[model samples]
Target: MKTLVMFGSKSDANIYEPLKSRLLNEGHEVDFRMISVHRSPELLERELAKVDAQVVIAGAGLAAHLPGVIAAKLLIPVIGIPCAAAVGGLDAYFAISQMPFGIPVLATAPDAYGSAVDLLSRWGRLDLQYTFDSFNIVMERHKRGLPHFQMLLTRAQAIVDRTKIEMKISDRPVENALNICLVDINEQDPEAPMPYGPAARGSDEIRIFVPALSEQAYREAYAGVAVIRRVATVPGGIWTGINNVGNAMLAALQLANAQGAHAAFLTNAKKGYIHA
Candidate 1:
């Protein structure tokens, strides 16, 4: 199947390119166009008429009416990708999603290329679903405010040990090995040897300290500990501490999964952090 990717400005290339690459990887012929609804309406119409595609992925920022306009003119499946260029893309999202009754522009998140591909797959054209090596294991430390310290510690340890044993049996090299990161919600006591557990110090483990949402909280909780600001490169095969651990497990898991980690264990609770 062929897919057409249309965007309002050249800056939208960042969003368009990735989707185009993914579509091409899924064995679909993709054509990209940098045209606008306001500026080049005639040219856009002419180009749209000429393209031979089964699906159209249109994106726009600010008002973000490009997708709606495309959907109005064309009969093919139009998937709208809102660009986060203005007002955190919410303006674009509303404009794309809240369309008139007759015209339907299927809208999704700003960077939701997989959803776009899934739309195609449902149409019985292409079969493309992206998956990473990192498997997520969610551990709830608390529902409202009940501390499950031992439970968190126990589950974390089990996952770590099991991963290590499996890796050892597989005999994968250190460079090509898997890793685990601790997304601990509120394990207080900075003096504790290993916050998550002793296994956290293992070569393949990363400790994610998501205690506080702000720098002030982090400084108060982790006084002497070296809390990573944004990102850090570990040269000595060490786990770096990332502070945004509340709902940032996905980001951490992406890193671990990129390195071929088999599973990512996360806690699904909103309890207070463990403090002294």
Candidate 2:
């Protein structure tokens, strides 16, 4: 049976390329699309209406309203994938299953291509007893998917070819931070050796400013701390008020402008030092 795997962008393809190949060998046709139903509803609906695939896997990240839209428009079985990230794929997952009434979009998990295949098997897409062998091969390969099967390198690389991060800080300690969060702090002991610095080493309502969003890099700021807290802000609110990390660093600069902070220092992620 032919199956279509539509996505919103090329990155979405990167998200599930391996899985698509897996489904292909199962004697199921796989299709991909980058059409935006919201942008071109008539065209999208027209194309989707023609597919009689046994199962359709739609992938999207961030505002992942694409999959649910496909499911709502048809009665055919749909498999949804929610691309998880550092924070969470909550929005993406919700977008697929949060149907108004009768519309339904079945999903597995973060990178649950196995679930999609499993669901198709239950639907009797392929003979289970004899065919599980082929599926087993796929599973074997996946167990060793990458070199380090145990570790998943989700640490988003420092955006390659990214320019330096320049930001302003009222104090020198923050001069080193661009896009940062206090993930942990040591349990303070009254007798613990205290490093000399600003009178109040740890203070509430810390302000971070950037010359531009480009300087805002993602990283855990604090370490060995108790009662870790995160400030309420949008995904890319630290850099910009928009969405995603693309223009986040640039947005950070705008925020700095609003707060009247001067670009006093720049860092390139190698050595935590200041330059004139």
Given candidate 1, what's the lDDT at residue 137? 29
Best by lDDT: 1
Measured on C-alpha atoms, candidate 2 has an lDDT of 0.41
Mind giving the per-residue lDDT tens digits that candidate 1 earns over 1-276? 678888999887778888788888878888888899999999998997886776788889889989888866755557787788875665676577555433446555554555565445433321111222332322233421323333333434443453342211111122212223333333244333332321222233222222222334444534323222111112121222223221223223323332234222211111112111
Candidate 1 lDDT trough over 10 residues, lowest sum: 267-276
lDDT of each: 0.48, 0.41
Q: Which consecutive 10 residues in model 2 have the weakest lDDT in total? A: 131-140
Off-target runs (Cα >4 Å) in candidate 2 are 125-276
- Which digits, one per residue and each the tens of the lDDT, describe model 2 over residues 106-137? 54445456556544543352232232211000
lDDT of candidate 1 at residue 9, scale 0 to 100: 92
Q: Model 1: residues >4 Å from true position, as ranges?
A: 125-276
